[model samples]
Structures are given as structure tokens and as C-alpha cells.
Target chain A: MDLSPSGAWLVIVVASLGCYALKLAGWAVPARWLEGERLQRAAVLLPIPLLAALVVVQAFAGDRALVLDARAGGLAVAVVLVLLRAPFLVVVLAAAAAAAVLRAV
Target chain B: MGIGAAVGAYGLSFGAAGVTAGLSTLQTCALSLLLFTGASQFALVGVLGAGGAAVAAVAGALLLGTRNTLYAVRLGTLLPVRGPRRLLAAQLTIDETTGMATAAPEGLAGTAFWATGASVYVLWNGATLLGALGAARLGDPGALGLDAAVPAAFLALLALQVRARSTLAVALSGALIAALAIPFTPAGVPVLLAALAVVPLILRRRRET
Candidate 1:
């Protein structure tokens, strides 16, 4: 489980290759195989939970504990900006700024 | 064009966040160059930053990158080219490019795809280099709240995908699972396990159909 700095290169190479392979598999795999309703549905549905989990982990998780730190404030700002229909850049920057301001105060 | 710029702009955050997460500037820029997908890149660095194992980090990133495969499936029929061009097409089959390409008029789809992909590629990589160098120079990233910004970026990325009720349900379920698992599981395990939240939605869709 432990990864040294040098091992990171291996991870980077492996992940980049794996991701590229996934992208290529779509192009190379038979169109018929992918056309199945269930397969396509799964493809479309998969990212939802993964992304949501990422948001939760990034915002709330800390050292194996669910700690609501400054990151939560940042995410709250991001939610508001998303609700207000802010552009992606604006939402991200605003969240960082909000968290920074909160920590400063 | 505007969309490419908007998505490219986020590359700066990726750069800063990557360095803040302890990646070398070269490693950070290499991610934008190679992985290209924002969420996957972030997941990799995010896990590494949290002191997770490399395997878990790659697993999370690869899971996030799976959507690009679906994007390629949809784009394969639209832009038909072979040899090296197909390789290039696969590399460029990301969210912004696919979105732009799919939405374009039939004759213009190829142009849309290439232009958006190229612009995003250039701007994203360029911004990544700039952001990484800039972050490296910054003595302490926490002072600028970069830690908080990383999750914020994830939220921004997720917002576009949660349009429908089922997707919302899946997202909430995933969030709940990750939150519950955080206390007991390792750093990236929760994210991977939360993907199981989609199983219920898939079952429901099959039943309704």
C-alpha cells in the first residue's frame, strides 16, 4: 500500500495507459456490443456516484475521519454558485476564495 | 470555443492542486498532457495528497475515466477516420470535446470536435504548466485555501452531470456511502465503493423499461 516518490511514476504510467486503453476500447469494441440498452445505460449511469463520492471525500473526509473542515465551507460556496448558475471557473475560484477568507477570519 | 476556454481555465486549479498534493511540476503537467480528463486527474492527485496507496489512487482515477470510453463510443461513428487519426481521436474524446462535437450540425461535427479538442488541449496543458510552476513557488498552499479549492473543483465538475432525478438520487446515495465509509475504510476505497450506488439505479431503470 505504501508508495514512494519513484513509484508514483509507475502509477502515473499505469493509470495513463489504462485510461487511454479505456478510451480506445470504445472505439475498437464492436458497436453492436455497446448498443445494448443495459450496457449503454450502465455507461451513462456510472459516473454519477463516482463523482458524488469524490465531492464528498474531498469536502468532508480527513485522515480516515469525516471532518467538516474549511473544505466544507468551500464546497458550500461551490453549491451556491452552482445553484446561481455560475460558470465553472467562477464557481471553483469563489469556493477557494470563500474558504481562504473563512480560514483567515 | 467559449466552452473550451472555460474548461481549459480549470486546468490551472488542477495544476495548483497537483503540486499542493506533492506531485512534481513535471508530474502534474504530465497528467494534464496524458490523462487529459479533469476529474480523473484530480482523483489521482487528490488520493495521493490524502496519503492513499498508489493502487487506490489509480483505481479511483481509472473509474472516473471510464466515462471517456463511452464518449469515444458515441464519437466513433460521428468522426470516422483510421490509423493515427483514430488514436488522436481517442485521446481527445473527453467531456468538452464530446459535448461540442455531439451538439454540432452533422457536417460540422468533425470540425467542432477537432477545434474544441485542440484548443482545450493547448490551453489546458499551457495552464497546467503555468499553474504548477506558480504553485511550486507558493511556500504554503494551505494559506490560500487550495485544499478547499480541490473539492470545490470536484463539485463544479459534478454539477453538469446531475440534471435528472435518477442521477441526483445516485449522486446523493454515492455521497452518503462515501461519508459513511470514510471512518472505516482507506482513503480511496470509499470513492470506489460509492460507485456501487449506481447498481440500484440501473436495476430501477431496467424494471421501468
Candidate 2:
């Protein structure tokens, strides 16, 4: 099959290697340093902001101009799903349906 | 994390997107197999679909991947494997694997990590192929708002992380950053901002007794 140029494959290889390097760096570092209190503390708290930023980006990025489009409508549906504690599958379907309908209209 | 199912479903969307963007099934599968990161893969495809340069898309994907560096640091110590095994372990170290593995109790960490990663890998790639084959019939997944499913699923994952004491602050910070950045940065940048927002909290914890 004709792929999108061999260069794209190279991109995949490099990206994969780069990701692996980061993963390996953790073990490659000395045990004592990694196990230290500072690192431990950082790990414990890192998720909060990382997750926060992620949520922010997801919610508002496309709404940049703040035009109330289907994406925004879908996001509202997602908010409701979270509030209702809907199952993941349910929430996803709800949001996707909302977006699809919005797009169609 | 239970987000594995959502991730798998999203892979279907990605597969469909790949086909629409002129990628073949083998190419889509290769993308999933090699660069298993969802957000980056999506960004790359989005860029490619938008007629952006392949080189630029690759660069954007790499930059977005910087956060995995932090995951490596955090999870590497939790589940240490030797040389060759380390390669496979790294391949499996996505958000779900790292989050589930790190949170699991001592003896169960390894098992949880492997299970989460392996499960996501299989389901995601399988769904990708399915999506690719059915791309024509699948229509617009975004039109169906399947795209929102991921963020909603992620929100559910976040809810599971909230404890009684810090739940409000954590949730607020995430919301605030997401809201603030949505207008400014691109898709992945907001996630980076969210990760960065936690740095102050980490610093505060360090200063405490």
C-alpha cells in the first residue's frame, strides 16, 4: 500500500524513540535520586495541574472566538454527563451525538 | 484506568480520520503501533488534514509529547525493568498505564500497569483497523460528537482522582486553566498548561512539614 511518504514513517520512528527515551530516563537515573522526597512530592502533585490544564484546553480551545457552535454544545453535554456521573460510554455517545446533530443542523 | 475503553473508541475515530486524510489501513495501524500517543497522533493527523507540512506536524507532535517525559520520571521508578524489557515497558507507558500503575498498591502495580497498557494497545489498534475499513460508512465521527467523549471520559477519570479534602481545589484549578487557555493555545498546549499549573502545588507540598 502507498503510505504518505516514507518520511512519515521516519517521523513515527523518531517520535516513538523520543517517547521511549523519556520513559527510560526514569529508570536510568540513580535509584536514590529518584526515590528522594522532592521527586516523590512532585509526582504526588503533578497530576492536579496537568489534568487541570488538559481540561481547560479541551473545553475552550475551539471556542476561542467564543462562537457557540456544535463543539460547544457537545461540551455542554459532556458537562452534564460528568455531573450526572454517567458511564464513560454513555457520556461519549451523548457528546458525540450532540456534536453530530449540531453539525448536521 | 477505565479510560481504556474510551481510548479504544477514540482510536476508531482516529482510524477513520486517517482514512479520510488519505492514509491506508496499514498506515493507520502503523501510526497506532509506533506512536501510540493519542493526542499527538490526532494533532499530526489534524495538521496533515489541514494541509500543513508533514515536518511541521511531526514537530508539533513531538512538542506535545514533552509531558510524557514527566510520566517517565514518575512511573519509571515504580516499575523498573531491565534493558530489553525497558523498551517494551516504555512503549506501554501512556496516561492510563502510568496513572493506574502508580496508583495501584505495591505488589499490584506491575500487574495493573501491564494490564492497562496491554488492554488499551489491543483494543485501540483493533478499533483503528475496524474504523479504517469502515471509514466510508462511519460518516463524521465529530459530527456525532464522539470527540467530546474523550474529554468527558477524561473528566470522569479526574473525578475518580478527587479526594474529599483537595477535590475542590484540584477540580477548580483544572477548570480554570482549561477555560483560560482554551481561547489562546492549541489543543495540546492547554494540557501542558494544566500539567504546569500543578507545579506550584508540588512546590507548596515540598515546603510543608
Give lDDT per model, in order.
Answer: 0.86, 0.64
DockQ of each: 0.72, 0.43
Candidate 1: the clashing residue pairs are none
* Model 2: residues with Cα > 4 Å off, grouped in runs: A1-13, A36-38, A41-59, B1-7, B10-28, B37-80, B94-119, B132-136, B160-171, B181-191
Cα-based TM-score, every candidate: 0.96, 0.69
Candidate 1's displacement at residue B171, Å, is 0.8
i-RMSD of all predictions? 1.6, 5.3
Candidate 2 accuracy as lDDT: 0.64
Error of 2 at B153 (Å): 4.3
Cα lDDT for residue B20, model 2? 59
Q: Which candidate leads in TM-score?
A: 1
